[model samples]
Target chain A: MNSYYEASARERLRLLLDPGTFHEFLPPSERVASPHLLQLDTPAAFDDGIIVGKGLLDGRAVLAAAQEGGFMGGAVGEVHGAKLVGLLERARDERPAAVLLLVESGGVRLHEANAGLIGVSEIMRAVLALRSAGVPVIVLDGGQFGCFGGMGIVARLCDAIVMSEEGRLGLSGPEVIETTCGVEEFDSRDRALVWRTVGGKHRYLLGEADALVADDAAAFRQAAIDLLDTKPDLSLEALTAEHERLGGRLERFGACRDALDIWSALGIAAPEKLPLLEADAFRAAVAGKRA
Target chain B: MEKLIYEFDGGAPVKATQGPAIVGVVGSGNLEVLVEPENLGGRCVVEILTAARGFGDIWKAVLEDFFARHKLADLRISINDVGATPAVVSLRLDQAVESFLGGAS
Candidate 1:
């Protein structure tokens, strides 16, 4: 297709897997749409804005799901969230080569607040269960909407995350931050500042995202293929190492006001120029400095 | 919060359909319709749970119009609505029927 980052959920699924290997479950035609949005006079999509299915990634059996960012900001509602839980649960049972989640959500749909929240928690539980079962869950956050709220935490809990420079990952959105903490604290209109705070590059530097790849379908597919063969042990030793790593981050830059300060603190010679560099160049610059 | 239940008669049984099918989302100004095959003896049953109250008459009129247009029968249509307009409700009903008939799949 065009660019993976700009493609729709179905297109992303097609591009990520080998051609003609994608088989959708509860596809839009099935009309398993949400029953809640209609009561409130809101338009709804046929597939509840999520496409879940089984596909082949480089000839390996894989289960994949992608969110539709254009539909309700890719918010996770009851059916959308349930589809993810079902997919992950199936992965745990089937032990697919990997479970790929093309996450582009803004967390729970506020309309169905309670149900959405419960669904997200269920997804987190399913992700943990799949991980414990030795099934890898790979998350790809490359959509313009990014991944935020409970979805951000879900992405972090995954085995691996592949993000693009154009993508963002965080708990709260920029607008929410600005609304909660005055403009002086966080100017939501400042695009650069917002991206610097939670963009892919920043998350990669913080060791939150595993791989930073080009915003292309081929690039993302290649990155996933490269990582599918290696399964990182989530043993106590690994958990301890990860705990220390995150603890060190908090100790070092938890008090830092600006993202540039964190970059400079990490020995990135020029923090301002970091965002302008290409993915490869950016990786090289922060290769040794990344925690 | 409004709870409305409307049962309509004089409709043919839904054909070429099996099992349950759902469509739409319960977002602001939106709603969802779930169509499940039931032995209602040629009657179409509709249950509406909405956040907007005092619209039972409007819901009745809209649902009556939908039932008149489709040959839906022996089905249970459960709706969870926020404040969807008549047009959206009609559309979701049609979508639910289409899906019930194995059109989308």
Candidate 2:
């Protein structure tokens, strides 16, 4: 009954991991808070708003991390960013069974601009390194904060992604789009439009997300456990297929404005009803149509 | 570029067991403290880098109180402060000390 979108970083980790098996690294008690935030007179959390640790998922060893969105929009500062890098590096060394990232971030912290940017790049490199080592990095983006900016790119680079219908995944945020392209192009206040453009359902249909699950923590955790059984092929052939898929998206939806066009093109009857359908019903409808 | 450096002497010698310990963050109204074991001739050295200038007396008072209460010795404490209150500074120092003494991993 617990919603993943509303859960705290610790709560989400507990729900994802097996019962009472999570071991934290550099926990809040270690007080590895950001040194950059102090110079800017901003309140900082002891763990730098990101919890990196290890746990068991269905009795399998897994490395996991979660972002605290309530703390400064879950922006990545120096220590926060370093923790992510360190986790991935550890994953490379330890070679865990899997790596799960419960991402809810707006990307870099503006307070530590340069350092945050560099940190994100370092994390991206680490992720690639882990992926190259055949370690599956899965992302579950179901939090209310969603994932945007550089984190979006990072999510895309991951092996697989499981997101809720309410979860959004995009490189640029709605506000940024509205400000840069004008309200006529993108009205940030239009919730429906925003969701249509970046929500989990849309990303799934676009082939950006691997799976779309319900908003509950149990649903997400189940989906993650299921994914662990199947290792995705990261070969060049798969990469080429993904490239074609992305290219096809641009060619198909290049001039499309209304999301209805997309739904209709995908052969969904009565595209208007798709948004209001429940998660299970929607999945069924999409499956039937695809079949 | 307003930086303040002060060193205090005549404090009870610390056990100096750990390498270094850090606590807190540098954010708005926050700061980070780094404590390292050093042989400073029984003196506790303090270095502060702060954007909020013209508070030397307040900084001195806060650090003095912390040093007096803890009686720490042979330690080099560096602070990167924004505008954190005396209470926060004190708490960070305590946290650093506890962490340095193998309190938490």
Worst 10 residues of 2 chain A by lDDT: A282-291
- lDDT per residue (tens digit) for residues A1-291 in model 1: 368776867678878899878888896547677779766655556688898999899999999999988678899999999999999999978999999999999999988888899999999999988898898999999998899999999998888999999899999999998899989988989999988999999999988888999889888999999879757467999899999998999999999998999999998999999999999999998998987
- Residue A2 in model 2: lDDT: 83
> How much is B74 displaced in model 2, in angstroms?
25
Q: Going through the candidates in order, what is the number of backbone clashes in each?
A: 38, 10
Say which candidate scores most in lDDT. 1
lDDT of 2 by residue, B1-105 (tens): 357888888888766456676566555677777787789998888988776789899889988988788887898887777678888988888888887777332
Q: In model 2, which regions exceed 4 Å deviation? A: A288-291, B1-105
Pairing residues by index, what is the TM-score of model 1?
Answer: 0.75
Model 2 docking grade: incorrect
How far is A64's C-alpha from truth in model 2 (Å)? 0.2
- lDDT per residue for candidate 2 within A240-280, as digits (tens), equals 98788778878987787887788788898887887888788
